[model samples]
Target chain A: MTAPIRKLRVATTSLAGCFGCHMSFLDIDERILKLVELVEFDRSPITDIKQCGPCDLGLIEGGVCNAENVHVLREFRKQCKILVALGACAVNGGLPAQRNRLDLRDILEEVYVTEDGLARGSKIPNDPELPLLLDKVRPIHEVVRIDYFLPGCPPPADAIWKFLTDLIAGRTPVLGHGLLHYD
Target chain B: MKTSNSEVSAQANARGARAKAARPAEANNVFTIDGREIPFEPGQTVMQAALTAGVFVPHLCYHPEFRPHGSCKLCTMKVNGRPTTSCTLPAAPGMEVENNTTEINDKRRLLIQMLLVEGNHFCPSCEKSGNCKLQALGYALGVMSPHFTLFYPVRPVDASHPEMLLDFNRCILCELCIRASAEVDKKNVFALSGRGLKKHLIVNAESGRLADTDFAPTDKAAEVCPVGVILRKRRGFAVPIGKRTYDLKPINEQADRFKPLTPLPKEEF
Candidate 1:
């Protein structure tokens, strides 16, 4: 008999986001059992892996707002054969990029020094563990090539399901007017 | 030469022909837009006519109730082989109009980009996300993102209306509110006071708030925003995602439901 087929390796991550997209992905619910039969998790939050190892697909959530975000996105691009921007944050910088209009210096000062409700000893929280913020937040595609984009704030669970199923079946996921929405 | 009866009649006819030639071309109420015949009433612009005929011409500022401002330039169409704004261009019988062409749509995409960059349109966070006409048009046009560099202009939000909020950052300057306030509401509570990039909408009060004016929440201007600029307070996200207007049906299909009449006999434009 011929050798058994290998399961597709899938990875996911959230950078500079509230993990809402990841939550939406989990919203796929009971389908996760069916998904396990076709694919294996690699460096996803679900897998709790430190690094992605030759993944077939990667779903990226959030924009590149900090150095760590850029690093993680570039790594996903390098490791995964197909990369999909999972939500509005990864597609157009989303709400996080609103800070791009404001002065970064002023934002830092307002939170760290000038704000009245801050903890008494709170500073800018400078530490080696923290990643440096970029002057402007940018969509993940600007930093790396994205194979696909899902345009909802956090795309509905059905939309994500359709995209994943299409990709798994080796078909291009073409979002109709009903499927694609910015809001 | 002796004047005869036939000669006298011919002289009078010649004078009549000259006067007719001097006058403008007779009005033709029929027109063809994209190979489809559209019948328009007198005084209707091409945009209005197309809308009445169930043809969706992508536009921003050309509301039916308001006078055509022609500022958005999104409804630019080729009328009689000449580029013109359909919102302001009156429909003429026998006119050949091309509204859905690659060239015109490309220009419209550029105009949409300019509007996005010139303002801070963060649709994901805006309360008017689903029902916002600008966002729907952007989706319909397949504008993946604001192609140009993000201008991210800083503007203030006026929350002093008590019942309404004025977020100038989302304003596309469609002048719908200005016209509604003046023509429909009869309050003349709004005006545009700047030029070029500095151009912006202003309330008719020294305090720069809607509450100061006689403007009420029930005014036509309050409900006329095609974008997320003028929003009712305390009603944010009243409709959840997936159940929103554009979410259930796309803009094109939504427009198709607004057709005014049934099938009519084809007529020449």
Candidate 2:
């Protein structure tokens, strides 16, 4: 008889993403049953765990758009052996980086102060609790080292499944043909 | 007159010879792409010949109907130990072309990533997400990350025209529209201005807007764009995601062996 196999510990988080990646992750559907047998969740939305423990794989979605994102990403990087940037946002700043051309102050003022529908005395918010926004939205790799990147708007559930299965089987994850898409 | 059996057989053979002369002659010249020998005619570029043979060379600005621009350089391959644009290179005998190699494909991947970061290719929100050549190429080449700083240039979207929109931010500077306008449509409604990094597409009207020109939906320039530069008024996501052209299969697999060689003259209307 051979030795028992240990489940691979995986952690995941969303920064500036729409949580579509996570939804797609859950979109793995009944494969989640098969996935659970091979991997255990840590600091994931599925577990509702806030703090990340030492993990085998870290799946991070979204770009680093603010101070809190950098802090969280750096911390997550330290605990995982391999870190994967998930989806288009984390790959290249995706849709959120569209605002990189405009000044953050101008965007805030336009939305909060000068818009036609805004109230008379409205101004940009400045609370101690709010995380300060960065001048330019950046991909996660600009802040920390990312081992692998999964591309797609929200990588198709099948793409994510293929990525995970390839990694689990000691293979360099290669998303090919129908499995790879940037949108 | 009564005909002998030998005379009738000879007449049938002569009739078949005349019919063969009427059809366009098939390509007999041969060149190798990635060690796979394919046929090419004398006038055809390597890309045209490759596509005609159902092979893909990973091009952006190349459309079969239009003349080869060779600007994108995505089709660069080692033609007998020298890197040459397959779109502009002529087919010759015993030409050893190496495409799909690890060295060449890595360069293609880098070229794509450079294009991706050089422009603001916001694929998720862009109307040409699934259908865009740039997006399809990014996936085709395994560009995991852009690996470069974003330009995020503040380019104007010319919605002055009532029927169409021109988003300059996504322009890869592929001059397909410029060629289609001047050569095919004979309209001279579009031109490129400036040099190097500052080079950009501009309308050929006095107001520098598309509305001031005689441009219409029927023009070939309106439909020759490989990216999201030229778009119609309101039908952005008409074909739902996961069902678009490149979504179902990669661009390499979609090359048609029986596709007509004529440039599409009426796709605009």
Candidate 3:
């Protein structure tokens, strides 16, 4: 007969988020079994891989707040055919962008200098190992062309499930009002 | 009195004629909103008619009780191939209005984006996250993000009142508060100042504080804000998440079909 159906390669990552989106992904619960049957994980948190490979879909779960985040997002955009911004953070910079009002230097001073419980000479970290922070937190789409957006703090597990199933079925995944929540 | 069948029929007809004459006559001028024919009364605006007919024309500043402000042009619709704000436009018979169109929605989305960028809409941390009309309209229109650059304008929060707090940072310059205070509460405590992008809400007190004015916690102005600008102190998030009005259902579903057209709860949190 014809060639057997191939499992779609999927990858996921967190940038400047609290990893709540990944936790929501896990909240998919028993449906994960069905998800695994239809798709193969590649360079995801579950796989612990260092880099993303050629994949059919990529779930980006945070806004870009650093040089490393930009690099990783561009890589995902390059490797994946469809990129989905997975939470409020990835969609609109969420709560992290609140700091956009304050000066970056002022923010650093508030955290590293004004705050107590550090070495007497505690200053802003400048280690080469650490990723450099951006002037402001920006949503993922501002940095790359995002194909879809799931808008929630961490989009409800069922919403994520519906998105995945709808995409797999070759239908345009339009989020309804019941499924879309900004909070 | 003994009556024949013919006489009884005549009496019944006369009584029916009297009852019909006693009733108040309503002039119904029907208009079409997105191809659906909606019957409107003589004095109703297009927005009022559409809302009465269970059709949503996403609005912000146009509250039903107050005169149509027409400040926020989010309800812009094609009335007979000409664009007009439905809130201010009077409904007329045989008028064709296109509301739910791609062109108008795109413009509406841009207006929303402009509003978002102009204000500090921190929905996750703001008290009006679920209950805010502006936020609900954003969701209803499928605005996943504020697609413009963030302005991050510095605005002050007036917490002078013991019972009320005015977070000016979230004000969209809707003037709902101004209308409520002047027309309903009769306090004349609130007003708008400046113009263009600099337009802002102001209190009538010399000290520029709400406590110095005659505004009380029970004033109609206190409950009229569609956004998080006017809020009661210490009552933030009184209703838990997922149980709020807009949280459970979208803004369109919550719109009612009859009088007392204020869909958002008045005193109830």
Candidate 4:
């Protein structure tokens, strides 16, 4: 008898976020063990891998508010079969969406320039590797085509696990009860 | 804990009697804001009715979902010539109200401007630049610079959550997030940690980082932040400026136009 299709390749990354999305994943507690058995995390901070390769799923956990985030998201879209905008920031730009209200020049000057800023020793390194901050924060789908959206500030862990299990089982994921629905 | 037949009947009759008595009182009463005449049904607020009537009043703390805290003095409107929070003020018929005036505008502007300087509101670098309610109101009132020096305290970045960023530098102490956490989401994740101008947002029960707290990324408190203080991780700068919320219309106008159970179009997604 043929072995069951036990594992799927998955990659996850954060862009311009506080890493709460990943923490939410951890908050799933014991459910993560079941998740790990079903999916192989190829490139993730938890795994400490640098670049993304081909994967069945790409879980992006932040808003694209900088040049680096845009670059990484583009790569994930190119590599992954399905791209999930996994949180409020990834979907509606979350609280960072408020930054879409401000001008980019003002942001740079406030952090880098001004007497109180530089005089108080706010350092802006001249490192070429650092990604430049964008003028505004934007949701991921606006930059690239997203297959699905799991919108919460950070989606609950059970919701994330349920969505993945549904997708793997070739079934459409149903929304959870009440306000917990990942809309 | 089994209920007897007589007890159940008595409870049912009592509930029926209460419902009947409540219906007439609810029908007879009309909601009003700051004493202005308004047709109000059940489950409506004074602020909701006033905004529906095209009366522009100042407010910072009263969001639609949370109970009115009456903490911010910005929404203060004169009811029977007495200053009161229109958001919390109950609707009563034959109540005279006054909102539009140079005096009120001046006070509102000063209060907002003070909030700007109270924090390190480096407007130039602020993520909530053009789209900020605080900034828009400041522009409307011709507040060019913070007339006073900024407090310029280097606040901590609660970078614990992987999906969101909490920068205390941009907070104006509006308490929208706090109310959203406490009342709407039923999660008391945020609280005012300090006093007066030195006040800052603290996470968890103690003065711990947000990562240490039980703050879920999906909490309304995270979503309700008015400034760039609480930022989502990966979704910023994904959409171009032309497509963002600020580019459409001022938030105040938008809020007024679509107040109290206005259905948003699906395309708004």
Candidate 5:
């Protein structure tokens, strides 16, 4: 018998996205068993590993919207040989980047201070626990060199499977017709 | 159209008169796009002929009913080894055109990317996500990402209209609305002003609000927007995402403009 194939270590994380992409990734359903045979998980929510040890593939969802996101993305990029921006958020800033047009302070003020339902003397949060928000919500590629971009609201599970299979087989991933939808 | 190619040459080859005489009358008015013979009328451009032939040459701002604006360069194709806009370039017999090639589509992707980043195209949030032509073209042409730094150009939202909304953030500057308003509606209610970087659409009224003008929801201009700019108020997400135009069929296949009309017939030439 031939030698058993080595499982590729794949890592995934979300930055500013709604976690819809992560949900879509799980939409692979029973394919998870097949995927496990091809790739092992590292630092992904699926594995619950807090830190990423040198990984073969890193699939990151969402845009870089804060200081913590930048650190996580850069660290993840350093560990992975190939990094894929997972969805519309990570690829082109997505819905979170809609706030890019407004001044950050004004938005904060509108939300925390002048809003109707706020409690008396409510103000912007300055908790040391919270990650500092970036002035503009930006695509992750702005902070790190991305190897591949898979774009969609939450790229359909079928598209994700196709991309992952292509990568697993050591071929260039191609999201074909009806696969690269934004919504 | 090149000014040098006069009417006589346009109808029948001025330089290839002998070759033209050898062919049948119906066969004389034909050109090849991607090496496939595509016939054309005297005044028809490569775009019209290709559309008439049921061939899809990806385009924006070249509506069948209106004059070819050629403003949006999405339909740029190689005409005789030179880059030329197909929408305005008058079709001439035997002129080779290269369209739907990897090279052309790649350039078109870059063009689409530029259009995406130049404005704030947050497709997920935009009301026109699935229905928008720009977004559809992005999908159809395989634009993996915006690929450029987002300009996030600040533009006004004209919610002044009771029945409509003008979200300038998504405008690709195709000016189809302007043409539709002026030519078909007979109401020059919209006009584009300013220069590059500053270029934007303006309402014709002194108040500069869409409601100040008599633009109705039924007007052609109201329906001509290829993007999310001109929208009907309170109609957001009405069609659902996956069922909208370009969602049901890829824009290239839906372009049905190619469903064959025998190149305008020889007599119309």
Candidate 6:
């Protein structure tokens, strides 16, 4: 007789980011095998089906800057039992937050609709599918309740692994001394 | 009048006898640091005791004459399981102190880093480049950069003081100069303004630039500043970097050896 497997479902989503966090997660290297054995990937691009569904852990990378990002984050919060804000962008808005000090209209006009720009040569329609931009880039917690936060430019791969493994084993994770505390 | 004078004399004699009776001949306790235990006279500060014990605790505001105010929070230690400022706490018996914890060192490093950022600490260009306590602490902590953004508040120099210069840029606001001026010299020439992050030293009550204040160059405040903020105008860069404070030993090690005479209550996380 074999012991029944306690399947743990997990998902990963990105918002206003360069996907550096996902790269860092991949850097877990050999530990990824151990992780895959413990948790079933649900909506991550690296594994499983692409469409997001109900999951045990929701790992969110990046801040909420656009309308679609907010919608996706809200959906994740509704679906997942635990939500982890991954990396600096999700934790404190990171480098994108530097632009938060600027006006949103100025950003749009400069990038998309200026005289020397994308909309200059053709007519640009205001489509319903296009998400509107927010005034400032804010960390995930500011918009909704975040269960855990890993703060770093992209949190060291070891930290992410520890968090995941501890959860899978049903044990409380202790942040390692001073090295783990960024603040 | 005659009765009052005789009464005063009798009271003085009684007080002198009481003082003599109260004085203890032998010291009460000795504590070990690293591996060496040193005896201290009653009422001597931990820094003083350590210095007597040949243990060096690098400090800015701690002077033998004045009271110890642990504002810098650089001289932090882990006693048993908690972090504490050492200068103000009284020494106790059977205390299990650990000053070399990575946590304590990190906190001290952050403290110095914050200090470096809070002021315009351009060591290479400043006159007090070599002998400054803040610089020494930076070198001791192995500070790479200011780490935080510089406020760069446009502070003016107080050359009004004939013999000294009060450059607010170099000021760490340790309050040593303020205390030394008020208590030791009996002159309230220096004052601190603003609060929290904005807190800084003001020369006079008016918050006028230091040059405009009625500060004497020979004021004790000018003499006591641990950094080059309050410099003796002519003596800039007199000491070379090789002979400076950081070259001696790391500040964390120096502070660890000089256990607080009295241990403060542990800080909560």
Candidate 4 residue runs with Cα over 4 Å from true position: A1-183, B1-37, B42-44, B205-207, B261-269
lDDT rank, highest first? 5, 2, 3, 1, 4, 6
Top DockQ prediction, candidate number: 5
List each candidate's DockQ score.
0.20, 0.32, 0.32, 0.01, 0.37, 0.02
Candidate 1: misplaced stretches above 4 Å?
Answer: A1-9, A33-41, A53-56, A80-82, A113-120, A168-172, B1-29, B80-83, B100-110, B237-244, B256-269
Evaluation by DockQ, superior candidate among 1 and 5: 5
Q: List where candidate 6 sits over 4 angstroms from the true fold.
A: A1-4, A47-51, A113-126, A175-183, B1-27, B30-87, B90-269
Candidates' TM-scores? 0.80, 0.87, 0.86, 0.49, 0.89, 0.51
Query: For model 3, what is the C-alpha lDDT against the true structure?
Result: 0.81
lDDT of 6 at A149: 67
List CA RMSD, all candidates: 12.5, 11.2, 11.3, 19.0, 6.7, 15.0
lDDT for each residue of candidate 2 in B1-269, tens digit (9 for 90 to 100): 00010111323433443444344333447766665666776666777777788876788888877667788999998776789998887777656666766677778888998898888887777888778888777777777788777676789799999998999989998999999999889999989999988998899998999999989888899888889999998888788877887888777667682232854223211
Q: Tell me the lDDT of model 6 at A88.
A: 63
In model 3, the runs with Cα more than 4 Å from the true position are: A1-4, B1-28, B257-269
Provide the clash count, candidate 6: 5
What CAPRI class is candidate 2? acceptable
Q: Give the best candidate by TM-score.
A: 5
Alpha carbon lDDT at B210, candidate 4: 76
Q: Summing lDDT over every window of 10 consecutive residues in candidate 1 chain A, give the lowest-scoring window.
A: A1-10
Inter-residue clash pairs, candidate 3 = none
TM-score of chain B of 2: 0.84
How accurately is candidate 5 docked according to DockQ? 0.37
Candidate 5: which docking quality band? Answer: acceptable
* Model 2 chain B: worst 10 consecutive residues (lDDT sum): B1-10
lDDT against the true structure, each candidate: 0.78, 0.81, 0.81, 0.64, 0.82, 0.63
Residues B1-269 of candidate 5: C-alpha lDDT, one tens digit per residue: 00111112221322343344345534589877665678877878888888877778777787777767888899898787788999888888777677766677778889998998898787878898888888877777777877788887889799998999999988888999999999899999999899999999899999998889999999999988889999998999788887887777777777574332443422232
Interface C-alpha RMSD, model 2: 19.0
